[model samples]
Target chain A: MIPNTKTDPVIDVRDLKKVYHIGEIEVPALRGVNIQVQRGEVVAIMGPSGSGKSTLMNMIGCLDSPSDGVYILDGLQVSDLRDDELAEVRNKKIGFVFQKYNLLPRVSALENVELPMHYSDENSHMQQRATDALKAVGLEDRMRHKPNELSGGQQQRVAIARAIVNEPAIILADEPTGNLDSQAGKEIIDLLLGLNRERGTTLIIVTHDPDVSAAAQRVIHLRDGLIVGEGESR
Target chain B: MKLLQVLREAIRSINSNRTRSFLTILGIIIGVAAVIALMAAGQGAQASITGQIQSIGTNLIYVMPGNQLTTATNRRPLTLADSRALANKLRAPHIRNVAPVITDNNDVSYGKESLQTTVYGVEPGFEIVQNLSLSDGAFFTRAEIDSRASVVVLGPALADHIIGKHEGIIGMVVRINDYPFRVIGVTTSKGGSQFNNPDTFAYIPLTSMQARVKQDLSSGRVNYILLQAEDEESVKLAIDEAALVLRENHRLNLRQPDDFSITNQEDFLSIASSITGVLTIFLAGIAGISLLVGGIGIMNIMLVSVTERTSEIGLRKALGARKLDIMLQFLSESAMLSLIGGILGILIGWGLASLIGFVAAQSGTDLIPVVGWDAILLATLFSTAVGLFFGWYPASRAANLQPVEALRYE
Candidate 1:
């Protein structure tokens, strides 16, 4: 694990902008957003609907390139990377946990965790590593169970295990507890926070819940594709 | 991603919707099966017809009255005198023998049984020129032909229908067109085709037929002349010699064309083969149309699959799958479906061909459908190409999807 230091931030963004063209109309999804986060910091991004938080998460996840920006993820400039190269960056350096716990429906929990490794270049001991990751999420006994076969909390745990299985530098979780009950959501939040504390893994959570935002070390509120406020959480 | 992994994913996805996948590939199956079975039938028909033609002596030629290719007004009937001229050993040295035939249909009866059958009036040379063999007694002699005796040699099938048996019926007298004639022999059975069957005819002296049946012995004209060459190598020489003798007998000058046409066994074989070849191609072309429809079916199914798996594509993309990976995944799925269909179609088509052969054999036709390895290879290659070609558009659409928009799709 890399030690947390103020000298170098794991994620750096300056004046990032994204505009989507819908026929003849230019729709601005992101407008001059700047953000920087240290290694291992748990940051929560809160916003209402139509605020472009999803677009921001897409940019950070390297799923889409920004229209204009100077963005660096883990010391590599990714704002100008092509689609395939961005995919490689996402495969090696970033992991994603969707709101619906987007584990492949038909595959087993262990196989779901192994998905990221399939895209990565690490071809050795993949099954063993997947099994170990499932054990870390406290669902080793349900490793062979599919996503639908597990409970909401268990499915989210499997999704977390999948995100961290590749040992990524940053875990981008979009409303990871949005589909679960309060108790299951708290269990998911605890599991994600535990992962950050134990592995020095960076966490970026996009959410509308105050409880989720309050649990983070820092919260950044977004409005109309720009950061409205930033503060340290209690 | 590993190729094996991609294929495994494709198989898994196909298995998830087994019924739809099978239905989608049904078009391919029917198309391939039709192609194989129809081609087999065509080849079988050609083989059967050609085999029958070859069974007739290869060195034989036919001289028919009038130019068969032209619509000329002036026509002359071929006479026994022209046949005799062609038969002269000195002038037509290549011709081994010549038979002048006078044919007429008559009702023959033996006791209570009666049937309308063709009566072929031919000279004694016909037995040798036509390669006829007797199953019972002997053919009518040259003396009987000269004396115009009422001795008849029945074909095997004709004797069976009238006398109910070939043995001991040689001395029986059958009434031909109400005139009594003694049956001397019955020729051996020669498997017949739809066009020509010699087994249903009766043979007698040409003089007897002209005097009794026709009642017009003035012209002494014959229907056709069958000429046998000394060997296969002399067939062309024999045709030329017979034509020259016939033209001389008919008094045609150098500037005028002869009023007759000549054809050999090779011409018959080639004509039969060409007809069957065209039939085979026509059948295969129709089957190919069905295969094209099947390809369209695959495209339709693939498009539906791409739309249904939109979120799955988004999930894979989010998990860092490249555009090529998604494209290959769908492409392999469609390819796998068509490959399986092609193999199944081949098995069914082979069984169908064998069944056709079996049915044909049961009905006394010696036709065996041939399913060549080349046909199977062609079908396999074509089906795979169809899968790939039809799979291209849907796969590209899936690959072009934006991950965020796809994930947001309900």
Candidate 2:
């Protein structure tokens, strides 16, 4: 469906549903979920274990498709898009920061950051863009260092650098500081907050930590497969 | 993804695990090397035989005494009269000189030095019909043949063996089976000569050999005939006329198979080449098994690699790599492994073939193995195909991985 004359929200969902089939068993991971967010809003998704928060994030990130209903990402109906097209959407619009950092262990930090940029349309200025992104995350000196060579915080910073290098519309962090100490976690949260405020990048974080949720301007709580509560965080 | 980028990634992955990559491609290297070496040997043998056939003479046909499969009752010994009849213009118009040869093994002695060698009693025209040329002095004349003179022409090797010197060999007298014969000339050596070893025979007049060397056979009989046609173009005509004359002389009817066999270099060439061709293909087939095994090894290792790097694959997909991208990455890795192996195999095969050829030459075998560019190209293409064929399943498996599931994998 086309967005009308009204400015469309960056992410729009309606009646989203997901079902997992493990052999003969049917596990309904999500059912009848609806959500929409503006272009520059920072939203945190919070829920206990088995609450479908991960599945919802997976749908929102375009990593997995909704089993039924519609997901409109940047005004395009992503639920109807094929796998390759969805991959393109993910590459162009979303940047993910995983809990484990997930930097390729053998590659240098700069090369790790250049991974997302390789998929980006602007191929000519990849080196410069990756350098700028890494510099922004204070990893310029660690550019040539590999993941195993770097500390946990520096590896996460490289991950962040990789996420923002392509200048995606939305940044999705799933437990971005889950493996870090409090100081490193605080640093990562502050860097993400800085990106949100300065660049007006839409941010959605899935986390169990209240400290992570408190930083978000708005928080959406999920239970089973539905969003049961919403509030502004202090 | 860019092709260059994909290739670089493949190279990097291969480089990261050098030992495993080397071990994986060892089968390919050995397979390709074996194919190249064996094919080269087959081609070398074919070429060597063809050269020997050419050295026999231009436009020459050999008339052997008996059929290859004929029994003694049907077998008839070729006679000098038959050779003489073929030389007659009325009987065989295209025929040139005919040399009827009668051969015997004899001990040749020069003073105290003695050697066992074949002695051929051939007519004066043997030099022309058998492609022998005088390196010193002269061949025995027809007058010598008529008189059954004791003049003998030594083969180059025989001259060297008897006199132990090349310069004083022309006038030296050597005893052939205790009969003294003056060395009138020495024939030039033709290496790897098949039908008659030109370098090892002592040639005397045919009448002398019939009377003294082989007293058992009748005066008119000889072992085989060498018939030289006017030119290469007239060879078929010459052979047909010779056959007709011989068949009439033998009193063979139309239904009867001829007692004698007449063959040319072309007949020998085709038969020899076909055998070598078949041998080459068989050897290459055996070598190809190793490449197939090598390919399977690559596929196995690739599968392990995909499983080990599941999270990396998931991360790449999440970062926006398509299925084709992932598939290409793995496919190229396997291809790169095999391509490198193929190249290395070519070098190894060439070196080993040359070494074998050199060793054969040292032992006077005269084999020269050739590793042609065609073999190299075929091996390259075959190895790449092997990589693609065996690499397909693992590549597809990696490509079809669901990002969420792969990401969650430990």
Candidate 3:
């Protein structure tokens, strides 16, 4: 292995492999993949069913580690990171927006957004920043509504509000519009694009929908845990 | 990191599962209440016995003739000369009261209802040693005692036996040995002193009981001697003086064994106290086992709750809750349940103990029930520790769960 270059990207993955072995059977989720997304790039990974898209999304989200390669997210090599360090990277660097809008059922929209900020190093005036994040997502009018009471689009917006509130460098949205109908999905994608355009925050979306891929500036297609093609957005 | 917030979350869990929480605490309540009420009742019983003994005149001392029911007669019975000698010649502080009594079984016939009664021949000062104040009528004077007159001072039980009412029973006559005897006095209803019944027999003059009932006995034959010292501290002086008088009267040397056993009220009360004390400890120790079972019940429920809320725990962990935060939350919930139950148990124990005391006092029984402060403290502390000990393992298990596996738990 040669010395890594000095001008490193925000997320750099080099020949990463993740294998799932159960007894005698071997399941390879990622087969020697190489990818890099520099700062301020809205990148999307597209793949069909059983194409290891969710597995790649999990690895990039820092929820799981690559089987045998280097993963440097925000200049820290995360392939060999311990549990606490992985948790620290997840907390301080990459923010997540799931498709199901995993806002806590009992807490309100503002509290759901405020939850992540509470765990961060941003100590003073946390409430004001949380409110600002909610207002930015255009859900300030529905601040007190619990996730159960909110519509699909509103819940996704609350999730987005939670993600960007921590001031993280990367926003990872894994099929963030999958649970909603087309109209609600359009609203969520529009919100995500607005965040990318306004804040210059790097965006990564793993989705099967071609229209979702078409929204991104750069789209990479995956098949059998390896990138088959890459093209610019129309 | 914030303890108050952790506690608040535990409290919220309690409120969310109201019926389940109440059921969990129920076991603890019954266990703690039983221990508190039983131990307190035992202590109160001991105190009541001591009080009965003291009321029988604290300055009193008793002399018994034999060690057993058989004829082990190294101890000699008191004689009239010994009583006369002690009562007349003893100094003031050492002897406040002295009486010689001769007792024998006799049949008293009152119409068709003839009952065998133990007739005790005693003088006026006999009331002081036995702690008897009459409810009605007057006791036989010194003259009646000396003249061998046929007069009787009835105990409460005997009065009920021979006559029906306290009203005008003083002048009524009852036959003893086919000789008419006037009822001179009726005794107050006194309970057993040092666990011995005080109201079982009637009192007669020594001269009369000897002449009518114990005729084979000579003029000097007295079965027992009762002495009452001035105070508790003066018992030693009184015992010493009485022993000297008995020695001189029997003409004994130091080589010979002592004639009688002398027992004071304090010795009797102490003996009673230790017996009850051991019994109370044993009862509380056994009842403590129930509290342990209750703790296991809490642990079982908490473990079930952790399993039930597997997804919820995952969500909480994913939402950035630390391990210790989750642990403290569950531990606080369990502690809250048992401690609250313990408080209610203490209250229930107190109420039951008080009712028991009230009922026993009303029924003319010697039993008394009370809640001791130490018992209450021990019960509360024990129940709380049960919560902590049994609650810890499940709480730690819940907190140590992997978020990924818990999220996937079906």
TM-scores of the candidates in the order shown: 0.83, 0.85, 0.80
Q: Identify the candidate with maximal lDDT.
A: 1
Per-residue alpha-carbon lDDT of candidate 2 for residues B103-177, written as tens digits (9 for 90 to 100): 888888899988788899998788888878888889888798899998888877777777887555777788987
All-Cα superposition RMSD per candidate: 4.3, 4.4, 5.2
Please give the ranking of all candidate structures by lDDT, highest first, separated by commas. Answer: 1, 2, 3
Task: For candidate 3, give the DockQ.
Answer: 0.25
Which consecutive 10 residues in model 3 chain A have the weakest lDDT in total? Answer: A1-10
Candidate 2: true interface contacts recovered: 0.74
Tens digit per residue, CA lDDT, model 2, A104-176: 8888999899898676667777778889999999989889999999999889999999999888889999999
Lowest summed lDDT across 10 adjacent residues in model 2 chain B is found at B189-198
In model 3, the clashing pairs are none
What's model 2's lDDT at A56? 96
For model 2, the superposed segments whose C-alpha errors exceed 4 Å read A1-6, B64-96, B102-121, B133-138, B150-204, B208-223, B230-261
**Candidate 1's residue-wise lDDT over B1-410, tens digit each?**
77889999999988988999999999999989988998898899999889888877899899999996666455778998898898899999999989999888887789889878889999988998888999888998889988999999988777878889867888899988788999999899886853447887899899999988877645779999999999999999999998999889988888678799999999999999999999998998998888888889999999999998898888888888899999999999989988888888888888898999999999978889999888899889988888999999999999999988888777
**Model 2 interface DockQ:** 0.67
Interface RMSD, prediction 3 = 2.7
